[model samples]
Target chain A: MILVTLLIGVLVLVLVIMAMGPLESLGWWSDKGAEKAAATIERLREEHARSDLRTSYSRYVVYLSGIGAIDGESRPPEEEPFVAAIRDGVPSACLVTDVFPYSVSNHGLTAQRPMSWLWRRIEQARFKNPEAMLAMLVNLRNAIQLFVSADRRYGPTYNIGTAQQVLESLLRHGYRLGSGVPVTLVGWSGGAQISLGAAWYLGLTKIPLELISIGGMMSDDYGLDRLQHVYHLRGTKDPFEKLGWVMFAGRWPIAVGSPWSRAVKENRITIYDIGPMQHNVKDHYFDPTAIAPDGRSYLQVTSDAVVALLNGTEVQVIPT
Target chain B: MGDFLGSLWRAILGVWGLDSSMAEWFRDYPHSLEISITIAMLAGVSTLLGNSVVLFLNRIRGWRFALSLVFNGVSMVALFVVQAVVIALIGFLFTGDRLTFFQAARAVMLATAPLLFGFLELAPYLGPGIARVLQVWSLLALWTVVTVVYAVGYWEALLITGIGWAVMQGLSWALARPLSALGNTIWRALSGSPTLLTAQDLLSGHQFMPVEFDFDVSAVEGGERS
Candidate 1:
């Protein structure tokens, strides 16, 4: 009777916990503020499409995925406007590449469904436990292995392999990046990995490329000198970029590659810091800084960086 | 405030089979301090947990092993085949009026969406081990997709919460096998130690000491085969 009562009590507790989860979530629910961002992206796409260029481009375009948005490529065309935006460029074919969340890097191990679930449950109980967080991160090695081998259904379903396939096919189709003209590579977060990889691939074919890393992490051996232009955007208080959170006791990727390192290196790497934004790459463009030391708005600073890169001028910012 | 009350009334009426105005649904929803804070916390916690589970599964098994990939591919192709039969069954079992195919598909998706994440969590510990590099690459891809979909727009709150919980439970169950293996390994390590177990150890099921030799001497009862 005692055993039966204990088992029943445990079952009841489990049910109660499960039932409480929805109420907690509902009480705190807010629609993800992504639609507004999408509109902005659409505008950017249109602006890029309408930009004056000397050469007529083919219908071939490159699709770069952002952080936490790798699966964007596989999503049905009808459901995603981004694909249509790229398609408008009239590229004979498109390569929708998964870029960010740095899937191939150690950072990829830190981003997974199980850890997110546990984090939510813990936070709901108003408990902030570091041990729990570390335990969740321990499975990093396993996650990396799974990504490389499994097919879409049987595994994480990331199209990392298809990236190579796309590169191969582009060659077969006679698509080539000119050495003199700067090839543009836009990336956010892990998508930056794709940008770097794509740049390297293009370099293998002797193409000169320019890379724009919005809200990206850098490595010491990133070889930024290889690119015609490199833009490193960092948010001042973005949780992901903040020293405390970015390193998170030294487990996170940013802990290893301080953005300051790029400024020190004479690799044509320009680093811009936007204050108090949460890991948003586009935050670089928002003029939100208070009391600028240089007496310029954040937007002006960003525009200047772009203009400087375009005009091939040098700016005097010393390495820390 | 009046718009809010009107929407509430319309919602109540709509539940009772009335045509409710859009104002009732949109205007009436509470945007109060208490409600907003609660909603924000809920959304934050839900996302934290949901993403945690995704991260955990990806870490343990990797993204390439996520079950959602299979289900999405299958659904993409065979959604109609599932709808025809499942919808008919649900209609017969509930209201006696058959549900439309779209309705049925929606119902199924709502019910099974959580299971997809759960399967992703379980795939790693339960299946044959995959190459580590491939696993990470795939996970990066999966993580990117999920983020984009959710980041681009606000999805149903209920769906997010449900899916998050399902994944956590499914992953826990999947890793149980690996956990058991680990437990056995620990047990063997302890048993093989040369030192005798203490009284406190006995209380903790560590009283037994390992013999100097580590051989089994059980007699063979069965006759030897020719």
Candidate 2:
């Protein structure tokens, strides 16, 4: 009889829980302003969840992800090892964070589906998703490819949307350099092109802009002429940068009459050929002060370049 | 090919009133009437010749199937048409005259429509698998028409069609085998291929695996910085 009564009580509780949503049921135990308080709490959580935005001071540091960046809170501050290096290395007065162009989750250009157990498993397993690509193409509503606020090649333009977002976040929350902050971009591999595109989309030239492409591609150099300063840092061993040139050989039309040539002549674009750096940057991240296999720390050199640019100067480059 | 097989399994279950999810297999199909008709006619002819040759040509190693179209293309189509009509009439009587012969015939045709994809059966390894799939889809299509179009009870519609189909199948087994054998014997005596094509080689699929394909598509996708 006691067991039967207990079962009945459990069933009733379950029924009550089902009849009221979990939040609303919890709210009953709280005060009159529970809903409003929840709303405010949720709002603050959203602001906090913008993990991509980190404010320092007047100088803004926008970090873009390359081809193999980890998603969400799975890793440490070094989830983005290169960005983490910049965040730790840069002055406390500068804001530093990675951007999300085509985020698979809730933020940025998201493609949400109520997944089944199998679908969820597949989602966890990172594979080439042509379905998302097709979806983006089908839903595209852009007027010009150059200004289309997206990465036309694949998923959301992580670089394009992120650059604007960093600027907006600074304006909304940063104490200094909100609208007229000097911005420094540190991009690796494909991130360099994205950073380049972001500079164009956000019109970062209006402020003091220093763009860095660390062994990145040049699919279209539409934004090369506009940035205040440009840096192309090629690692001795990285093949990804060479892939773009290999695929587009007119031959190596990117060299002749390239916008960078003019920029280079005007002392606006600097190319650094680092001898010891590989495409991965695993060796480069270890010691900021120590010299690399190339005899000097490329990381220190790149950061110093940003520092010099912020100071209205240039980093000397070994001529290509 | 897996997609086609999955659709077939769904269709088989659908005919037995298990689930009506069979249409998903052909949901993307344009349902072009002209294409469907052309395919059905082409398949009817090919099936007729293939079955006839397989059954009759090699009397020493003779085998038989439930249905054949080679020598009896007209007969088989006519028999199925008759079977559908009988099912429609029986359904009308069973359901208090709610279903008409014409409506049921239209439904039957619609049900058989996906079988036109069997046309792809000539594409080496994948053909037989896809054709087998279409046959299952055809049955499911019949169930769809009976239930959704005629508004009949799922079980009753299944029963009426099942009985008619079984009867026709029995009749074909009894009559089709002997007739095809006689035709093959006569043809062999006249102009049939002297060397028999091995049944194993003809029916069994390729032993090779599907080609492996890989792409670094996520490289193009923007995610968190790795």
Candidate 3:
């Protein structure tokens, strides 16, 4: 009975947390009022103007890191090489990696929040004791934002905020207006949902937008109608992506009227098998030591697939 | 204040039909003001936090909207009283018991305790499902009140509430056109809008249009800021 009560308490807490993101977006529990939020964007614009890299690039590649990320600037050691590979592969495109996908205001977990100390401790624990359970809190917090982005009722508000952040980041990285340069979003894991969420608002800017999901778990409800194309790079060994397919009704074959289904019917989504890579385990998608049967590292294979998609080249699919 | 909150918490548990002792506490101390406050909270929370309710609220402008809100809440309470009287009449017919209208009213008001959390109906994706669950929970609570509190047999109580519900539904169906017209008239008089925007219209209108952003390359130098 005690266990059952505890379980119920936890469930209620989770539901409360789930409701909070949308409520905050709706200005219910917002500490940062509309003026402040707008001011933040204005600050970004001013910073962009002051930046040395003001020259227009032909294309912009925005990297939205996975749920494990603490902030915009910090990248996990394991993931850094993969990002570096993408930079090397697509040197012509300006890569913007400082837009934190989990935050509506682009505020990081450690960024002056009420619970900043807790998050800081968790971030430290990830390095101090790599196997510490405290590190999972980062994933738990961000995973909730992913759901908020997928919710139809709340997605518009949350997505619009993230999209604004993405736009600001693009401008900061020298993306000239009306340059007609195609913007590619390289989203890893839960970042894929944020990318898709932001796609509709980004599309309004008249910039051609494409998505590259690297082992991303996404729901089908986010407006897929606006995206130019979706390249889902999945691994045969990864079961996490399949969880998305099973969990979301929109991803189901029966939901023919859903945006995901319509997009699939239109052949707007391309699925590529990027060899025997796991989702986020030791030999995950970005693990440089994880070698496939063809002798290329998982990082190299994933990066090459992303580069191919960015360059408008057909990516080779590895057979199961 | 602590005592009041404690009692309210117990009242919530009682309405879930979870604790018989809590149900007894509610029966012994049937505070009219407390029950009325609970009902008002239900209406106010639903108005403030419910997504669909917010859409309707958005249509209304100025201080009259608050007056209209209070009017609607009072009407809801009166409606519940009328429903209780109808249920009491039905119970009298089913069990030949002299269940007073006030007794039934109290029971009905207490049953609505579960719906105080109706604000949660604003939650995306799971909102509809949660609403249905709360409805079922309230039904069970009402049934428990009829049986355990009123001392009516379980089957007889079920028959009474069930028939009463059917009768109410029939009345609603019969009065749908007239009630809707009356509601619209009152809303128009209170709010400036003749009709509220449909959910689709509201949602579509709420889409993010980047009107502030400069799309032209030449206008980038003096881009519009919010």
The candidate maximizing lDDT is: 3
Model 3 interface RMSD, one decimal: 6.9
Positional deviation of A201 in candidate 3, in angstroms?
A: 1.3
Give candidate 1 misplaced runs (Cα > 4 Å): A1-63, A70-175, A221-225, A242-264, A280-320, B1-226
- Judge candidate 2 at residue A24 and give its lDDT: 18
Task: Give, for candidate 1 chain A, the lowest lDDT window spanning 10 residues.
Answer: A24-33
Question: Residue-wise lDDT of candidate 2 within B1-226, one digit each (tens)?
Answer: 6754454445434443424444333333344233234434654554443233223212112222232222245444554476567767767777766655545554554465554334343322223444576666666566665665545677976776676666555555565556445444643564433323221221121111111112122222232123
Off by over 4 Å in 2: A1-58, A72-89, A104-160, A172-179, A248-251, A254-267, A281-320, B1-226
Superposed by TM-score, candidate 1 places the C-alpha of residue B80 at a distance from the truth, in angstroms, of 59
Measured over all alpha carbons after superposition, the RMSD of each candidate to the real structure, in angstroms, is 25.1, 24.8, 6.7
Among all candidates shown, the one with the greatest TM-score: 3
lDDT (C-alpha, whole model) for all candidates = 0.35, 0.45, 0.71
Model 1, B59-130: lDDT tens digits are 212342243233223322242233334434533443355545543333223222112222222232222122
Chain A TM per candidate, in order of listing: 0.41, 0.54, 0.89
lDDT of 3 by residue, B35-85 (tens): 636664664456345433343213232465455445545555555766788
Q: How does the DockQ of candidate 1 come out?
A: 0.01
